[model samples]
Target: MIHLLMEAKKGRLRHEDEKTSENDTGFATVEESALGKSIGKMELTHDLITAQALVFFLAGFDTASTLLSFLTYELALNPDIQTKLQAEVDEAAKAGVSYEEILKMKYLDQVVSEALRKYPGGFILVRQCVKDYKIEAERDNEKDIIVEKDCLVTIPVSGIHRDPNYFPDPERFDPDRFSDENKEKIVSGSYMPFGSGPRNCIGSRFALLEAKVLIVSLMSRFDIVPVKRTTVPITLAKSVNLTVKDGFWLGFKNRNR
Candidate 1:
């Protein structure tokens, strides 16, 4: 990929140099765009651009697949939710599957939100403390906790998502928790499917859009049902990223048939 991008960068530079006007700034590809911006700058190296591309690709690809896998598994297990989501998809299909209409899907958003809550792409979030911070005591029995500068803090995303305090009866697959009325009751920073604050996953919106689009497209023509090989109460694999122990085995039944 880097070799191809380097070749493309050379081609774009050659094309731009041949142009009569130095101000002509049309870029055909992402490589061209990045190369154009970094042409005069020494700090922005080819290695940096390659790293950026890899990060974007890996982060978006794997996480989106993981989200879809878990979401489909949940849907297969809970046919009622699938039926309701299918109805929503059917309603949306009348006007066609445009970005605007998909964004307007309330139940779809809720279902996706619930799936993220249940099985987040990343289990933990790590942040390095820029400066010293103090945690004030909440009750008389508790003492203040001090975190010095450069301390590494880890937030267990999965643990917090399943906490009864934030999500009551957290084990159950409940999309209503994200309903307009009930969602407001959720504690801040408790629902970080893609982490929270400024340094959160950059591809979060795109990832959600991808999941929604796939679900809508698939559920529109087919129903996702569990097969004999389907694993109930999915066994999580021992890895940094979320994975089903034996892989997700689902059956797609044609709705028309």
Candidate 2:
């Protein structure tokens, strides 16, 4: 995934270079300007291109790493859920499951949703203050919080997801918590695995679907058993964006051929 992002960045850079060169040549010839003037303009263009590429490259890498960590931890912890998911995949394969068929797997979807809720890949959701505003307190006992322009606000996603008030026994791995009926009870903005609003992760659906397909395909053919080395209490990697501390190590055996 990181490699893909790098390759994309390189491709973007190459395209930008081509465009810049063409523009510089065209402008210089049209205006009969000196080569030095064209070179100066090109240098500025190069800086802008470098900045854009760096931003996108970092963004892609961060997003990909977060997603991989989230999925990895869920699979490691939930063996029973994994088994059921494998069963679904086996059945689907025999019956020729399409993309549309995968979308209808309510249980699978619920599992993924619950995993994301419990271990939101990104711990913090940051927003910049656009205007001075007074944020009202929801609780009568608490005072209203004041906000100034250009201030950074962080929404603690991890705390919200694990809040006992919103989810009873939040530590338990229960997909049913996100069931159609129970879902209505979940507070808005409290369950944002992919951050909420217009600027939320745009590729969330694609990433999730890809993960499900990959897991389904692998599980259909193998029985993934926890080895002695597999950590019982998973730890989050402090350095990374996702919940991967020590890598998940499991033993896989062919499922009855």
Q: What lDDT score is found at residue 18 in candidate 1?
A: 43
Residue-wise lDDT of candidate 2 within 118-152, one digit each (tens)? 77766688999889999898997999888999999
TM-score of 1: 0.81
Residue-wise lDDT of candidate 1 within 96-206, one digit each (tens)?
989888877889988999999999897889999989899999999999998989999999999999999999999999999988798888887788887765566766766
Q: Which sections of candidate 2 miss by over 4 Å?
A: 1-73, 137-142
Poorly placed runs, candidate 1 (over 4 Å): 1-43
Report lDDT (Cα) of residue 190, candidate 2: 70
Check candidate 2 and list the clashing pairs. Answer: none
Task: Name the top lDDT candidate.
Answer: 1
lDDT of 1: 0.82
